[model samples]
Target chain A: MTDNTRRRFLKTLLAGGGLATLTGCDYLSEKTWFRDTLAQGETLSDVVQHAVTPRKAMAREYTPADISPSFRANGTTDPDAVEYRMLAANGFRDYRLKVGGMVENPMTLDLAAIRALPSRTQITRHDCVEGWSAIGQWTGARLSTLVEQARPHPDARYLVFHCADRYGRSHSPYYESIDMEDAHHPQTLLAYELNGEPLPIANGAPLRLRVERQLGYKMAKYVMAIEVVESFDHIAGGKGGFWEDRGYAWYAGI
Target chain B: MARARLRTVYRHPLPVRIGHWVNALCLFILLLSGLQIFNAHPHLYWGSASNFEAPWLSIDYHWSRDDGYSGRTQVYGWQADTTGVLGASPGRNGELEGRAFPSWLTIPGSRWLAMGRSWHFFFAWILVINASLFLIWALFAGHLRRLIPTLEDWRGFGQSVLDHLRLRHPTGEAATRYNILQKLAYLTVIFGLGGLIVLTGLCMSPRMDTVLEPVLEFFGGRQSARSIHFLAAGGLVLFVAIHLFEVIVSGPVNQLRSMITGFFRYRDEPATDSATTRETRHDG
Candidate 1:
């Protein structure tokens, strides 16, 4: 074929291809295939993140000068539950964090025991899904230390955080989960203190997960229990967290 | 005497047309969804950290006895009451809602942040992929040459601006190719601003941050990336407004036809063979 005709033919083919791709996006979004692909996309990002960043790489840390005066607690500001209120009333001295599910040894540790473990202090920014951020110094026990004591079974793949906050009277309580990789990260802390003082009630007093690389919502506040699980399939809404169940991406790293 | 046929040119190639429409759709979805996402937290910051204490930019609504129904915007410590628009507006429900941008302007048209994020991320993939493909194709096909400014373009730029100010458009031979103004604008949109938007967007991703930490550092921090993302989006919105205006001003029928079908008819001059020769050259 002559160059002119070949060019014309190719142009037509390209236009057809472009049109197909555009329509394909529309049709695919409605299909289960697309949803699964997006889910995979989340995993893809996780893989890429792990591949690119060094294992011990930390989230950017700030000095005390950068700390916000009022961090302005997000999500559930106050867990107004009778149990949570009573626990808070007594300075959470009696609070116990149960560590079970897919673990070789199930153990419950009180606030004192948790605070006694070797700790990590980091002044890091908390980026919220809502596009706000705040810096605060978090002092807590390394989650890996707790995971080591719990002795998660080989089948365990995720660390689930069960929290005190339940919104809108949902039958399911507020919870969040992270993969084993995040659970073992050196910076992943079960923070009990903020800005030199004990963590305040609004900021998840007795305990809060500090998965620094992720968004604010992933840091489950007022953590009541820690569960090791192979998958979150049987968890509330089968997505992972309260927000995840409501349609937020379970892997909110991006 | 026999009359010459009116000449037509291949003003827009198939690939260009396809890229244009896809980007347009992506931008529309992105802007609306971005606003929806912004409504989740109406404040913007410069450094990596921000809270109630300080934000370089913030859009919020507050009620006071003196300033009822006022919507405030503060930028770098300078505050203003943009009440009728921006910070707050009459929501879709017709109630005065305190949102950064009104519900009508947001995707899902409600305060469903999760849904907004889903839409944003989904469309973001589409935009990124589509734009990447378009760039590659444009480069390989040499279509980029038409958009990139030259020394001659610089010489003609002032004239083009003057003509634009007077609402004058090129005629005949000059109209066959994009004017300097068009080239510069297209180049900025395609190469400069488009890449900035995408890079800043990637920088905002917590996962991508791990992968692109060094690149994100160039933008300063995550919050800086977010701020740049929003600002670049504003530039895009401005481009679309001016683009649509130019389309209408330059003869929407001809512009629309060229983009839709790749055929553009020039002004008729039955006695002129120059137009036909030039058209043939373009076709060849």
Candidate 2:
């Protein structure tokens, strides 16, 4: 009796697998009902998150001793090509990071000038989409401080990062952008250090942007310039980040 | 070599076994990646947006310079003196990195998040189907009516409750097959894990927003789904831990062989008093 029942159960398990396995074709054509989290006391999700959540999210920091020895540089590490080499050879002495477009004050600041600006230090982990992580002490000027200095125009809704790295035959440069909320985030910084030392060449030497709130790709290593844009449509890829253009979600909070 | 013999004709069905291991793997990956996500904001809440990113909640960091920069070493610590939660990350160097599954694919990425999702969802169906099938099969096969307890179960159950409450075993029966305690716990897990995945998937899915909004409300919201998912995963982990302990105590080969072969190896030891068969010996 038990034997018969067990076999039946096994057969049923397999049979259930045949119940219309997802064809993946219906989603785009349908009315698409999955967007409203508000109807359900999603407000409750909000309330609880607010209660336990930190006012400012802090990455689990580590001492220099805890920093990884070999942090694999993902995406594009050094900005592409010979111009970056020339800059690297000269220690990026004359490199300029411009924060214009949609800003009241268009400023062109050299590496030294930007470094001279008030800075913030944070020891945070860099979360990569590739399934790895690393903790490093990053010291640099707060991105907010720079945003304040640049005084973005009232309509500026996003901050786009223009980079020198590109994959394949794309004529446009590798670029990424984030909303104003991430823009003013306290952890966000134009980082110049990994661990307690200067940013290594393979790790975006001379400068990089760290929007700690998002994934590592959002951090945009090998960043060449900061563009304060009113919208992201005009930029390369148009979807936001190098990966985002490829169908990755714009908001990778988790 | 010593003589070895096949114990029974029963074993875990292939689909059930596949589901079990796949769920295990998915849960492991989810936990690891989930930890990385949680590290972004350790504490979670019920809302769409959280302000833990605000400046006020930030713990201050200060370096107390020794006598001088070149002289005494500085003390590196949090200014307020709570656990700095100082740590690094896992998977920094491994076979898997950036292998994000494509959006259109069943899994989410080539190797990481997407695959975890795919495995998790696929195994979820396996678990649900197998569990349901087993329950129905048990009911139809007279196993539920006969093997499942009676008034005796309640009495045994009361004593069992007392035993567990007092952290002692009852005198009436040493649990065979399964005790009252096992039934309650396993049933609870079956429900909890199953419900959690469904609830979380509903909460996370951009597609289920309207249909399962009540569920989201019951838990809280989308973020609540995340919270529940995390909690549920943690609970399943606990279940796995305790399950391993029981498997160890029960004699791994004997119990496992029964599950695999679908027949308990008849054994004789000095354990019989009621229906458990006295003088049972495990020869697996």
Candidate 3:
């Protein structure tokens, strides 16, 4: 073939290949097998991260000066649920956080009861899955204190946080689950205050989780119940969290 | 009358050939999927948190009843209209969509951050493994040495630059080995930019931030690391453009064949005594 023809052929070939690849990716994304195959990367990341980092490694904390002036509240700002609105109307005075499931002691604690427990105040960055971050001070009772008091069963492996909000157009109840390791981490908290003030309704009023090491989605807001379970397979979408059920990685370490 | 001989040399080994193709594929998927992920936020910041008031770079769109759709890209303090590409682009349905990158540039060709992350992370693992293997092989096989420039190579750097600008590639024995410019560029892309991109990627991960706190500190913060990651990726794209341009200018068919089949063919001077002697010495 002439040099010009060869060059033309190569150009056409590259263009065809590129188009094919893009369409192929789109097609593969729709297939369950391809998505499952892709999920192996998430598994790998989780494993590698756990292997390299200390189990109790704390997320970086910032001072008051470093706190963002305006923290953008994402996901469910105001839960449309009637019960949530009623609780908000009463200033969450009668709000109760139920800790149950596979725990020996199923405890129901009110806001003051929860606040009476050992509390921690930390100023850490909240990283969203969309790639934005906000630094704010979070004050709440240590999740470990509650978990210890509840006395989880030996078989209990995950802590599922059932929230008051329903997310997106589907109106799916927002929920997230984390392993015992993260549940007991020093930074993990059932946060009730933001920037030293009561957590705003936009940010998640009454209470939210502060899983500092994970992305914001993993930190379920407006947490109404904490269920200790052996597995999250029977949960809402059966993938641990609302976003996870919608194709986000269950392990949000990355 | 003597005729010119077409001398062939085994330029690329099997491992190198495999690594090259794998790296190329990984880079393509990573870049497109990365763009898809970037579209979710469409802005970059510095330091720890995203200072919403001021961003290092941002892609934004404004739609008015009279003006229709207008896309704007702001870098530092400068702004430019980048419609049909950045800020607003043609979507899967061929309608204008407010997105950081065009649909054609994304993996799924739509706004799908979850699938995009899946693609990005999957290929990222492959890229890291492939790069690690290639680096080890290069180190032991003296391939790394060939990429590093010598004092002699540095002395000829100016000439090499001029030759490259003139599109004058080496011939005969010189074709078998990398030139000084090639060495430096390869070194930078392979070790400098490649390493930076991967490290910055890790820095973006909250979990990784805990493990690699020193690296996070070095980059100032996660947001800073993220900005640097995008810049490093841009640098890599630039390198690939120049690399492809060089390949095409020098000889695409020959270059492609060499990368694929490991054999490189170069035109030799007419079968003369002196030319034969010099070829033998260089090959040896």
Query: Which 10 residues in a row give candidate 3 chain B its minimum summed lDDT?
Result: B270-279
Instruction: List the global CA lDDT of all models.
Output: 0.81, 0.56, 0.91
Which model scores highest in DockQ?
A: 3
**Candidate 1 lDDT over residue span B1-284, tens digit each:** 24334679988888889988988888987898789898888888787766455778889998776655668999986999887687878865675768888765777566778766766777787788888898899889998877877897787777778778766676564677887888888888877898899889888876567667788889988888999999999999999999988877777779899999999876643332333344454456
Which candidate order results from sorting by TM-score in descending order?
3, 1, 2
Model 2 chain A poorest 10 in a row by lDDT: A31-40
- Candidates by lDDT, descending order: 3, 1, 2
Tens-digit lDDT string for candidate 2 (A141-203): 888888998999888898988776665456456677887776787878888887778898777
Tell me the docking grade of candidate 3. high
Residue B14 accuracy (lDDT) in model 2: 53
Worst 10 residues of 3 chain A by lDDT: A70-79
Better of 1 and 3 by DockQ: 3
User: What TM-score does each prediction get for chain A alone?
Assistant: 0.84, 0.79, 0.97
Candidate 3, Cα interface RMSD:
0.7
Instruction: Tell how far residue B55 is off in model 1, in angstroms.
Output: 3.2
How many backbone overlaps does candidate 1 show? Answer: 1
